[model samples]
Target: MTKKNIILVVVAFLLLSVVASGCSKKDSTDAEVPAEQQVFEETAEDPDIAEEPVEIITGAPLEEPLAEPEVDEIEEEEPASEGSKAPEEQSTSLGDQPVPQEAPVQITELPVESQSAEPEKPSGPSIQLIKTNGETFYMSLDDMKDRSELHFSGSFYWLNSFGSTGHTDFKGVKLWTLLEAMEIVDSSSSRVKVIASDGYSMDFDISQIKRMDYIDETNQDVKLPIIIAWEENGEAYDPSEGAPFKLVVGQKEPGDINKPQWVSNIEKIIVE
Candidate 1:
């Protein structure tokens, strides 16, 4: 045999010897560990398994659980004896004594002056007549009605300021008759004035009072009388339509606006 081949054989044999020794040592270490210790170490190292911590006992064990306490029974009250009275009866019992009662209260009435009363109605004269001689006379509706002989009933046509025309049936005394009755018409008394409650007034000549001349619907000369009226169409005037007295006159001519000469709610008549 050659020397180089002999040296290669020796080196290969030593390498095989070292490998065999390592495998034998690992087997011997695994065999020395317990099976449970091996399993615990494997479980700790595994990512999927969670390891349980060891619990060490440090003091005495807990005593047995305490028992619940027992409940006590309630005692019943004893009944009253037949010889003793009840509390309500003992408080109410009073022999041979009368009970007292409270007295009633009295109320006072209010005086008659303190009570409310109805308001009195207003009173005023119906009409007043003043003469040029400074003689004044106040009259009422009853006084005027007493002179029934001078009353006249007629129908007349009239024209108002608005160009409206109307015909009314009137019952009243004539202006001339009223004037003559009061001796108001005289030669020196050239004019007469009629006034309303609202302060409206109109003046008239004595000639007009004696004769109120007008042209009829046919445009012919006709003479009509002026009157102080209290009723129209046989009915007394309403308060809204010039109550008590109204001055009315027929149209002076066919187209004369005669309403301006008329007066409503006549309160005064003066002859001057």
Candidate 2:
């Protein structure tokens, strides 16, 4: 063939081929797009793929909690019962504690001078007389005695007329009598505690004294000589036997020399 005729034939054949291929491509694209969209909708709406209902579990039972018990408010009690008196709240003091109360006391008269002797002082060394109120008086026995030489040397006697060693008379003034003679008074419940220089002490109740009882019981023999003596055996009291002054209680048994009680030192007489 000639070169121009061959070229026209090839160009026609290429254009027909391109037109057929475009038609086939358009049909294929439309079919594939519809199938893909349907598949996607089915995947989205499928019940099998949806989330299942969850089974929840709580450890405790599901029953509702019991309501809190109702609180009954307490009402004030009635003032008094039908025929009874109202209750009274009584106060009490502690049983163990003691309440102080006024106590009773016995009183005695002050020492008043019943009789006054001479103005002469004690012939011996001065001695101190201590009073209950703590006052001290410096005086000799003479200054404080109502009778002369009642407390002097050789004033005491162990009467040996019976010649029996145990049956002798001791002449002296009664202790209470001497106390009364000195204007020393005491109450009914009083006691005279005589202390010695060596710290020995003896207590004599006025009520128990034989002479005091003798005077009170019989109301007689006011002259019975029971004395606080200064001498023994015609000599001044030995310092060992409470020199200077000692108490000699009269014999309740007459002529009983063994009954001549000799006590000494005469430190103090506490009357209570």
Candidate 3:
């Protein structure tokens, strides 16, 4: 071969050898890097690739920013309540309010009356007494013998379907005395009703309650009074004329028979 051709061939061979070695070295380095590592290298070199936060949303609308749970402001301490001290006082709160306490009442000490363990048997005729609370009490004439006295005059008219025939005089005890004896607790002005075994009943008006000694200074009787007559004309009434018991109302004159003044066979008395 010529000298020029030989020089050109040698230079070409050296260039090819250098290019082949460089290519082999680049392939080996690239193969050593993992795919994930390649992505990290690219991301590190590229400033534009930033990590952005990811969020998953559901169908329900976000509740008005979750209105941060309300917190009550602490309150200033309050003054001590009645009948309570500051340090020893108990505190209780319902929601935002505190309970109030009432002051204890001061009462005067009084003597208590003595009572019998067992009720005493009545000494007189049997009579049923009903109080306002539907309580029933049994009593007798002798049971009320020691009670307060009530002296009043009255007249009884022989009552029938047609009308009154004649009249008789009477004097006896006030029903108020019997009710008081029953230990009835109610208004004194409450009505008093008397019922008889024959189904006859009479309601006495408390507004009419009056006694001869209680006459007002105005020359007018304050009220009308009711009485249970056990005696007539200084003696007990005859059986034919309602014996043993008869209800009579106070009347100053015999002409007062027009009013309901008589109730016989009285077996029950009610206080209301």
Candidate 4:
């Protein structure tokens, strides 16, 4: 070979060696890194990657503080009440409201009697019956007790139809006793009048409840065995049930033409 040709061949051999060495180094470096690690490294260096620098503490480090849960903030509102009236022209907030005042009752001079009069009977229950004659009695309910003053009087159950034959025991004071006490001047007519609460009236004949002439020669018990009941079935008499006073008369015998005649609200007793 010529000297010039040999020199050119040597130069090409050195250039080829240099390129082969560089390729070998690159291959070794690529083989050392895993595909996943290579991708992570590239993304970490990229500007668009969502990465934030974390501060690292050296030595005996402190524990990371626990993050607090976020909560929504709420605002308090005041109540709008009737007593909190707003000023006429302005938007008055609750905080700017003025306290209300109560009106004072006016006091005027008046006669002493007018001020202290027994506050009038403001319309309620009042005694319905008026006293006419004989003896007037006022009984207090607050002091009533059992077996208290047995007053009995009655009339025929069917007055018009029975005449004296249809005569029945009525409600009122006992005829014999009342007559005996009133020192009755006359009982010859054998007539008695009983008034009821509903303004009902009935006439009673003494002959129907005639003096019982049984075993006892005098026969005082049978003659005046009448009852003035204030109650029935262990309870006070209802206003509609003829209570406060009721008269029940029982004759000596069941067939004695006197059974049961209920008369209530006895206003007066006339022995004629």
Candidate 5:
């Protein structure tokens, strides 16, 4: 064989041995790595491969796992019967109570015999003349008309406290004539009290009751008798002018205020 052929053969065998040794070392390293470590490395390298989550156990393990509690089901109520009422429809509230009715009242009218009658009116105007001897005489206008000698008509001047002076005509019975007829004026009766219906009173002696003298408006001396006047100014006396009866008297002097001596609405005359 030639020298160049021998050298070529030797170089070929050395190259083949080096390749075989490298293959065997790679196979041994792959066999030494655990399958789990290999799979972890492969997973870390490959992004597409999803790694399963690992659970870390802490404290002590329980004997058993807890179970879910069971729930109770609610039952529905049945509808009420036609004859039986529901609890809400029962009449138990205060507004549902029945009201009591009241009875009607009856009225009765009074009979004619049970009613009161009206009182009768008086007959006419009358004066009560009382004497100290417990004797009462009721004198009226008719008594004055029956006796012509007792009635007198005259005009007399009068003066009042308010500077008023006037002369008025009057017609009535004389007080002396009436007293003489009734036997009231005597030596035993010294004073006479004249009272009015409005609680006014005047006192007169026996001499004044029989006669009174006055000075007229002409300053002339005039004499007159005290009279129980029933008419004035040709007209019957009205309530405003002391109706029924009034004791009239004239002024004694020119300035004598004798109007207070006149008793108006004379209701009573007492002789004592």
Candidate 6:
């Protein structure tokens, strides 16, 4: 044969061998990859296919969660019914003595001014009445008697808010008598309010009179004597001197013996 014809034959054989190799590979793949495996691979490659996630639990069935202990529910208490009886008040007794019930006190307001009508202007030194026992009395020096010409003569000083009166002597009508004349007693549901003509006033406890310091004169230590003094230094109190009448307490002093409980220009005293 000619060399060109030989070369052409060799090239043809090489092409045929390549074609045979491809056919053999196809047949082997079809036989080895079953239809199921081929379908699975196709489905895995498809974008529309969704695969469920698998959880890898490597432990024994989790010990069944321990049962929770039962808890007792607390019940709420109901309010007392309207018809239920109220508990009786407890009382204390001393020895075998019977316990006493507290006495009812009559209601009263202080400064007694509110309990009465407007007062008439005083033509002279006067005392306006404020009675807790439903009684009233108005009086001037003419109507009041000096039950005691209380003489506070000594080196006694009168300390007051404005200024101090040096050791001086004071003469005045006894206040206890005045209170007695008005029927004030410890049991009365009232306190004493001394009001000045100019509206200045102070309260005096009626119970103070029962105190030894007030009843015992030697008790110079006694709560200083309180008074409705019309005179000081033997002279009547002129307007310049807290005139007409002035309510004062204390006999001597030093230490917060401060400002006398003196409400000057005495006009009225109310018991309330």
Candidate 3 residue pairs that clash: 124-141, 124-142, 208-223, 208-224, 209-224
| Candidate 5 segments exceeding 4 Å error | 1-122, 217-221, 239-243
**Clashes by residue pair, model 2:** 168-257, 172-225, 172-226, 172-227, 173-226, 173-227, 174-226
- Per-candidate TM-scores read 0.50, 0.36, 0.44, 0.31, 0.52, 0.44
Model 1 spans with C-alpha error above 4 angstroms: 1-125, 212-215, 218-223, 239-243
Error of 4 at 236 (Å): 2.5
The top-ranked prediction according to lDDT is: 5
Ranking of all predicted structures according to TM-score, beginning with the best and ending with the worst: 5, 1, 6, 3, 2, 4
Task: Report the Cα lDDT for candidate 5.
Answer: 0.78
Across residues 160-261, which tens digit of lDDT does each residue of candidate 1 receive? 889887777888888788878867667788888999988999998878778856545543555568988888888887755554898988866568788787
Q: How many residue pairs clash in each candidate?
A: 0, 7, 5, 13, 0, 1
- Each prediction's Cα lDDT score? 0.75, 0.51, 0.62, 0.50, 0.78, 0.61
Tens digits of per-residue lDDT for model 6 on 110-205?
Answer: 776566654474676567766776465666764543444443332235555665444555666556656665575446545778877778778766
Q: Name the best candidate (by TM-score).
A: 5
**Candidate 3 lDDT tens digits, 1-272:** 99999999999999999999999999999987776666677777777763642243444465776667888998988976775664334466556455566677998755555532334435556577777877678766554444446555555444333554555666667766656655753674467788887878887565544343222122244444567776777786554543257786544443343335477767877877
Better of 2 and 3 by lDDT: 3
Predicted candidate 5, C-alpha RMSD: 25.4
Residues 1-272, candidate 2, lDDT per residue (tens digit)?
99999999999999999999999999888666755465556656886644453343534456998999999999989777666873233333678454455566978765668443334434463334444444344444444344554442222224344653431223333555545555454454366666666666666665644243221112234334445655556555554544366665543444445232455666555554
Clashes of 1: 0
lDDT measured at residue 158 in model 1 versus the true structure, 0 to 100: 76
- lDDT digits (tens) for residues 1-272 of candidate 5: 78999999999999999999999999999988876677678777877773564343534455786677877766777776876754443435666664444565877878978865432323567677777785777777677767888988888788888988788888998897899897766778888999999889999887788775645655575677889998877877774555478888876666788877888889889998
